[model samples]
Target: MLPGNVMEIMASPSSLFSAYASFSGSMMLVRTMVNDIIPRPVQAYLWQAIRRLFKANPPVQEHLTLVVEEYFHGQNEIFDAAEIYLRSKIDANTDRLKISKSSDEGVLVSFAKDETILDTFDGVELKWKFVTVTTRRQRRVSYDEGEESQEQYFELSFDKKHKDKIIGSYVPFVIEKSSELKGKEKVLKMFTFGGYGRSWSSVDLQHPSTFDTLAMEPEQKKAVMNDLDRFLGRREFYKRVGRAWKRGYLLHGPPGTGKSSLVAAMANYLKFNVYDLQLSNIRSDSQLRELLLETGNSSILVIEDIDCSIDLPERSAPTQKDPRSELTLSGLLNFIDGLWSSCGDERIIVFTTNHVEKLDPALLRPGRMDMHIHMSYCMYHSFKLLAANYLGIPDTDDENHCHRRVFTEIKGLLAKTQVTPAEVAEELMKSEDPHVALDGLVKLLKQKKRETPADGKLETVEEIEDQLKEKVKIE
Candidate 1:
């Protein structure tokens, strides 16, 4: 049945291809391939082979293939060295350094089993030793797969000792990434120390698809990608730019704007873990410090809904504790770059809030929150993302009369409507099929537009900034 479908597609003229000519596309009977209809194990091998031929990045395979080959050679060399080391141990009679005890509570040693031979100190053979010693073999239990298995070896022991020898012990510790290990490589290790953070667990992030499930407009998507490239940074080049080994990013916009999902994608792109810091969990500065210290290096520490976590000290109600001061601001500052802020191994700290301007100025300073990313509403391009994500159309960058009309309405609606990607996604999910829902959004917008009055003018930023200065005076 699958072969027949492929045969039909191949046999059919790119005949039904006119609509796609304008870079327009269609929802298809086959989102994937005929072989994809087969069992996964067989498909896995075929997909593996396909990746060799056509990877997302062609250079990756070429370099990766060479790297694997090099690793194989290096492993062989290590095995050969091990073989030589084993032969040397069997062939050489390495001098044994042995210790023995004496009657005076001082230790005695011997070139021979008899202590008189090598016990001489300061050119005098001391016969003051009043104790005798005996040596015996120490055996440990061993497991054998079969009766024919080779014999077990024994360690030397004193005749009187009954139990096995205690092995030397040392404190168990986790080594933080060292500067030497990072070297000139652009990748720096992210380390958090002396902070209130999870010592054993850091938040995990899902990978980002190269493409958003929702289609984006070509120009808008390009702009977003370019902006993100500069802000989120490239894997290989960020450190050379004199930026901090760690960066603080602010993601702010209306609710349900896909900020959380974008974070997941960013982590997937960077292969970073997420350390989701909760302000409520941090009642004291020290607890915050500890939590920060415990997070894994190469992580994205996120404080979602940051604006609501604590009102700006000024806006906060009067209390015994000064709400005007972030009870933990000093601690947060230390984690940022204060003298106490040890540059952690390369990490990105993300703070998401609907209200960014309300944040404390010191907290938002250049070095503190290095990047401010506005995850704005679903623009025309962003609509494409939604369409693609829900509709699975690969978005041939199409702009038909219906598509154009609907997207234009969405853009206008977005200008006034505080709809979130999550909200739109919810709508898409409510219907059994997305293509039909995409059409429904157009009708919904028209009805909403008529019901709502035209967007009345609002105060401009300069006006609001001036008004805020007068209306909301700070002490």
Candidate 2:
């Protein structure tokens, strides 16, 4: 009747539960009023009076007429069930409902679109209801000064879910909360609609950026290409390996060696976003873990110039630092290898350093640095690669006469000249005429030879590589 005057019927918890009582006393009382409480003579007289009133007011009679069905009948099943769940908040069949744990509780209900319930009494049951859900309750604070006549206690309590957990039109994963007091293990995943997040397993490997384009020499290029293919293939094959799904690479080489370019190539090849993590961006190791957790998958986490970015304490140094600058070496170590690393994969860790020797050994241990790639200087092969790349003329097995002659002269000079491929590429850009640059290059090599005397005054491919290797190594 007019939604049954909800304030009176539901304001009290006891009154609300009365409707669902299996052996309902109120039902019996209603029946008793119909059968015994009203005498036959008095009921007949009352019925006559009601009949006269209904004849006088047909509209009121029409409004009052309802299909008298079972206890739960002709009601909006979803809405009524939800309302009962809200106020009474109990599942009568549950053993826990028999034993009151606290003042408040919650319940979870599962239902099907079409069930046996429709066949019997409106297709719903007392069991299909919300019990007092046991969730972590957060206490909110309210403060007012000088006005003292309220229930002015120290704290106020409310359900955590009441405070808009489902943000920005996103629904939360419907998972059960733990009953225990300690922190619960949660499969918490954050997702934004149509945002750019990807899985690393889907990274494309056929792109030119997948390896250092500057690499040359049949054996060297083959190894570099194979190593890269094997790396990507192996990762794809074993997507979820070991406890941690992380893959680490250590790129070590002299400055100007294409280490950074290799990283850019990797990101471009994979189409993975490059998360260039500056050591300065992270204040401490714990913060580092948070950023790692927040970072999208299908991305590379780079710590460039690892040896020089942060003042990494030596392995034997104090493990813990004062609270002020609490990002100690141990905390970083724990994250890199401990339980935290197992959080997620779909990511790669790349550490580039010109001073690999200066890095702590612990940081470079086998599993710590999964792959070690050394980016070295221009060999005769790499020189030809630069020649072809910049000059747009084939240097090896060349049918082009001009390119072949320049390549031959340059190959001879490479024996005596210790210029970088970076330098060679630079010089090639100065003149559009490859032959003219080749002549100038030969003259420049002679000038360099006179001014910076050849280390041991002779020339051979192996000797040039060794001498240049020594110079590059020292540099």
Candidate 3:
């Protein structure tokens, strides 16, 4: 062993310890001096200043934030689309998520406020932050201030160089993707006027009706479906012809004839939201216009029992008050086909009435009520459908089935009398067994026939003869 080297190594430990002690003493002295000589606030300010000088600020070229607000006018489609689009980006690594479910819809998962979601598009890294800001407002009604309102937005951060790409390509991509995603898991919403402001409140639409289950005449059902298809595909045609991209339907029929059920079927087939606008709750024409504006695109606005919903006095009648503010037929007609109808696109307005003959000529015109669907009484065909739907009886043209004898008798009764599909459905629903249901329905038909007055008969002798002759011709 080298004596000199050993001594140096032993001395180095003491030197290093002394240096560390000196450094600790110096730090303690500086801290004590700061406490004694400087005010606490001043020391804090100095400390912040030092942090500001050294804290890393992202380069200008690397930072850009695009904000998407929850609403600007009415409800913003972009905000909604973004919300749906973001659902696909959620992953196990996500720190926080919000989960909600409607009574009839699948569980919906979304990113929570202040949660960050990272995504990559075209090799560009994108960061999304859900931000919520709350502000207090004064309750002017009580002359006091204690209410808090919240506004939410999404902050999309990416490199500054990709701004054009994000706007031109990525944003549109999001909208398109959202539409596809929405189509896959459509949860129809039914909105009604309620709550404090008379605004629309929505719940999951659990309607089980569809075209197949609707017991309308085959010809009429086909016509309605065809009309809807034409209307949906003619958006550009409407634009070229300078027409508002909307359609109006007037469903007129007696009670229990499935007017409301048809509306539900249409909504289900189109995958559109249903907005039941109660004109009775509406006070003024302006209010109706505002409510219409609040509705989303691809929605069916139904005003059931329109003939009795409101009193549409003749336009010639003089008004003591300002009629502009009142809910008048003129205002409704204007919103139906006039300039206000152009406010939205891909909309359908349905008006249901028990008396088609009672509606004003202006209200029943071609443009206002484009299609007039007469939901007539149940025919032999509709009875067969009800039998099939309720009793699991297969709808068959073959007359050799065991229930054929009962169906034949029911058909004869239907031909001679008027019975609503709803009534037949109720009778059919009484028994799960097809034979029992058919027999009970036959008894009801006989009772109804025996009670029918001579004047109340559905067909005259001449009409019956004509139908017989037409049937012979077909045969």
Decide which is better by TM-score, 2 or 3.
Answer: 3
Write down the TM-score for model 3.
0.73
The candidate, 1 or 3, that scores higher on lDDT is: 3
lDDT of each: 0.49, 0.51, 0.82
TM-score of each: 0.48, 0.50, 0.73
Error (Å) of candidate 1 at residue 271 is 0.2
lDDT value, candidate 2, whole model:
0.51
Q: In what order do the candidates fall by lDDT, top score first? A: 3, 2, 1
Best by TM-score: 3
TM-score (C-alpha, index-matched) for candidate 1: 0.48
lDDT of 3 by residue, 1-475 (tens): 6699767857798877887899999999999998999999999999998987897984346689999976555456887788889889888889899887865567878777799989888999999999977666664578766555566789999999999999999999999999999978876889887413435656678888999999987767887898899899999999999999998888887799999999999999999999998888787888888888888889999999988888876777888888767888888888998889998889999999998778899988788888877777778778888888999888986868888888888988887776789999999999898888889999888887777655674763346435433322100
lDDT, model 2, position 162: 28
Write down the lDDT that model 3 would get. 0.82
In angstroms, the error of model 1 at 133 is 45
- By TM-score, highest first, what's the ranking? 3, 2, 1
The residue-by-residue lDDT of candidate 1 on 1-475, one tens digit each, is 5788777766766744743653433334342554458777877888899887886764521111000110131112222222222222221232442445533234432222221111222332212111223323232355433222111111112212211211111001001122222232222122222122223221112233443553323443354455445554554565566445666777776677667776666665565666666676465666566556655556677888877875433423455774323445556776777654444556778889888887777777777776666665555556666776776545444565445556666666655544456767666666756557876776665564456444554323244235333422111
